[model samples]
Target: MTALERIAEWVTSNPPVTAARRAAATDAFVDTLACMVAGASDVSTLGAIAVASHADPRESAMCVDGAMRAPSSAALINGTAAHALDLDDNFIGAATHASAVLVPALLAAARQAGADGAALLDSYLVGLQVQREIGREIAAKHYTAGWHATSTIGQIGGAAAVAHLLGLDATRIVAAMSVAVSTASGLKWQFGTPVKPVHAGFAARSSVEAALFAQAGVAGRSDVLEGERGFAALYGAPHADWPTAPIDTSVAHAIEQPGLFPKLYPCCGSTHLAIDAVLDLLREHSFAAADVAEIVVTVLRPNAANLPYTHPENPTQARFSMQYALISALESGTVSMADFEPATVRERRTHPLLDRISVRTWSEKAERIMLDQGRTPHRVELTLTNGRKLDRQREVARGAVSEPFAPWEKRRKFTSLSGLSDAHYDAALRLAASPNIDAIERLLAAAIRLRNGAGE
Candidate 1:
């Protein structure tokens, strides 16, 4: 029995308490929905994704704005839109966008399946737990070896959601898990490319296909996870060791740990500490980008490595560039959606400030490999020419698995993300406190209608 086997049995039995998972699901749900709405107007990128997906479509579920399409296509668009701004939540342990990767896909499938909000919410919890467990089992090992954990571990989440929705028998669920092992994919090298968003879309599409295959009595290798030639052997070597026997997962870790970090910024969580650190410094002093001389950031490996191209030629690449992001923060006093525009990144003023920024490992905690990152966590030190130097450090970034979101913080985040008016905000509170998706949707629709009629 693999971890999937155990999870399948537990979820099959417990079916998960809706009330328990509801609040968390609703929190993430509201955030994902907000991102989708905000992103809907992003005609260039998000619009492209939605248009590309329009080529082939099916009506399995209705998306956030209430459009119906094929399960796979719906998931792809929703996943891409939810993550377009890079503001969705992340999972440190898994090294990926936790909610962004899972919620959109499940929401589409469940809504199309006519699943009540309770079932949809419960399935999402199951997906979150399963994906995180897979991530812990692999750790940074596979990711360091070059796999993107969000796509790699996230497919399992897709599988979990699909299984719960279909009521797959344990055996079939185990087989679907096997399909996921083979399908696990995503590359960090593609961070700045359109393929980055494709990672989320592919995971969502694969899960739907994987589940459909299993439902059709297609059998996959049950031992694919721990098998000698399986996922562990092929992709996750050097990190492949779980306590469960080849056929025993009865004592698998309980599936009820809290979910991952809900993000505030629209970039990698790796960038958060630095962003927050820079903001911290500004709290004390108001300095224009031109006023600042050199801003130095010393941090961990990819935290440093994840920084986008020094000169981001495009919006997608801007997400990966620390130089650009930090510069935008210094100039704008915040990093907003507007900062990523082509004109913004190309501005001569912003470029000079970005050029003034330099990052180095400062103190070599370890030798610099081609990417010389030390074993110890990276610490950031920003120095300004005004003879001002500010220091900030985090062993674990705030939204990392080490530090999770507080309930109130999540609500505040959700409310802000939902773009709900005062009345809608209060109404959403009621809906979130005891979720009824249909009722919530109706309330949301009525609010919009009211707002529109007011102009008349």
Candidate 2:
């Protein structure tokens, strides 16, 4: 069978995921919801809502404005909101923002189909696994080729999730996957722009539409992902390594290996390791931001390429600027969402630090080591005016699988973003464990109300 067929079978097999994996999926869902709430007020999100509303007058629940929109429109708006601040969870291997795409698509399909929570979780897990596998097959070549995996790979994954939620058979799921491949599109060049989050929005909405169309008997080539002139050959390297066999999720799921990296700061994941390394140094010594004469950060070549901005003039650019992220963390002892605001990025105090900070590219050998270890490697050096220097290298950023966030930290993030009462917070956690998605929908609706300042 073709690779696409094998993937379809795997997705439809309903492989058993461990309770730990399920819990991790739940955490990812909750974290993405928090990010959605935090970014609800962003202009990019508002613009997306406006666009989606115009295209489709039908209404569903939008997490941002508490306005009902069409199911696909809701997916577009919610997905855009989830990624507006670049704070969504990322899968390192795929180099894709998995939850940002999957959650919006799956939530839209589930609500439309009246799917329960367990089904939602299952479909999400399956979609994440598919995305990782596809990402692994394409390797870094696809991303390095300037294709944004969050939209390209994520479209197929979103289709799988929606197909699973709708209980499509293997053949129909294959059709959905095939149809999704044609809809996949995004460019890395759009990074640092509102178009970046719009990529996630397009991926989510298009994938849902693809699945729904397929389910309605729209025919598509089942081998669209692996045939000649297919997804890999067209979007990735012509000679890229495609998976030869079907993956067994029952043996090991993607959520349990090379897992999701939840962001503690609202910036690009590429800058996270450097921020952590700098914060660690600050904790070890007694020196103010002014004490440092120079800060040098060395990161993998891919990371260096991702962070092209040294002196950012806006929040969008600041999120991708290694210099900005590192210096802000040092100056404030923490890089909160507020640090990425225009006022903070343009503050006079940050200009001096931005001048002192330099980001360098790591050696090719270090990049190889990072690929082998599945880590985001970064080396930090702070040179004090007194001529003393402190240096440290971090292989993994905090909040990665190796160093997961504590329950309290997750709760704090949720409460801070949603501004909901403790009762609502507890209800969200309960929804995670419950089999009822109606409860989940209600919880999200309440969050939307709070975000829009309607229920206060």
Candidate 3:
């Protein structure tokens, strides 16, 4: 069987997802919901919501405004909002924001199909496994080649999730995957623009449409993933390997392994390890930001390539700049969403720190070693005016699987970002664990009410 066929079969089958895996999936979902609520008012998200509101209207929930829209429109708006702040969960192996794409698409499709919460969570688990596996097969070359995996590889995963929600058999699921493969398109060059969040929106919308089209008897080539001119051949590296059979998830799902890396800061994941390293050093040594004469950060070559801006002109670009992330953490002792605001990014105090910071690419040997260990490594060094150099190296960031957020910590983060009361936060956690479609609607309604009253 072809790669797409195998993937479709796996997605349609019932994989044994452990309780721990289910809990992790719930955490990812809750995190994505918090991100959506927090980014609801962002310019990019608002603009996409406006556009989607004008499109065909169907009955589905809009996480931000609590409005009902068509499935595609709902996916478009919610997906865009989820990624607007760049705080959504990411899959390091896939080099993509998995929940940002999967949550919105699956939720929309589920609402349309009247699928229960259990089905939604199960589909998400299966789709996430497929996305990361495909990423492994393509290796890091797909990302290094300038393709935005969130939309490219994510499109396939989104389709799988939607297909499962729609109860499509293996044959129809293959058609959906084929349609997704044909529609996949995104570029990494758009990283610092409003269009970056829109990429997630497009992936969610396209996947929903692909699955719906296949359910309506639309057909596509089953071998679209591994064919001669297929996704791997044209979009991935020339030497990429295509797996003949799907990786078995019956014993353990991918969500239990490397899993999802939820963001602690509202910046690019590439800058996270360096930010953590700097914060670690700051906590160990007592020194003001002004006491540091110079700072240097070293990271894997791929991360360095992702963060190209030395001095960002705006908040959007700041999210992709290692200099901004590191210096902001140093000055404030923490990096929060407020630090990435336009006014904050333009602060004169930060300019001095930015001038003192420099980002360097790690050695080829170091990069290979880190990759082999399945790690994203970073090192931070500070040269004090007294000629003392303090340094720290981190193999992984805080929210990664190696050092995941505790239950209370994640709850605090959700409340902080969503601006919801503790009661609402608890309600969300309960709903995430039990997931009925009707309960989801009520949860969103309650959140909207709280947000309006809080004037957030």
- The candidate that wins on lDDT is 3
Residue 180 shift from truth in candidate 2, angstroms: 1.5
lDDT by residue (1-456, candidate 3, tens digit) is: 887887876776677877677778878888988888888888888888878776454676555678888888888888999999999998976888999999999888876777766678888887898787788878487887889999999988888889888999999988988898888899888888899999999999888998998999997999777778888889966566667765687676778777788999999999888888888888888788778898888887767778877789899899998888887887789889889877888883347777888888777787778777777678888899999999888888898887988889899988888776677666655654554666556656666777778442
| Candidate 3 TM-score, true structure as reference | 0.95
Candidate 2 stretches with Cα past 4 Å from truth are 55-63, 432-435, 452-456
Worst 10 residues of 3 by lDDT: 427-436
Order the candidates by lDDT, highest first — what do you get?
3, 2, 1
How would you encode candidate 1's per-residue C-alpha lDDT over 1-456 as one tens digit per residue? Answer: 666676566556654354545665666666666666555444433553556456344665545444556777767666766666778777654667767667767765675455666666667776776776667677456766677777778887678777777678778877777777778888888887776766776777677767777777886777676677777667756447665633222433222343456776766666677777777778767666666777777765556666757878888888888787788777778777678777876673346766766666534335244222312344557767778777776454455445666766655655565555545445444544443356555543543344355420
Better of 1 and 2 by TM-score: 2
Clashes of each: 13, 5, 2
TM-score of each: 0.82, 0.95, 0.95
In model 2, pairs of residues that clash are 58-70, 59-68, 59-69, 60-68, 60-69
Error of 3 at 314 (Å): 1.3
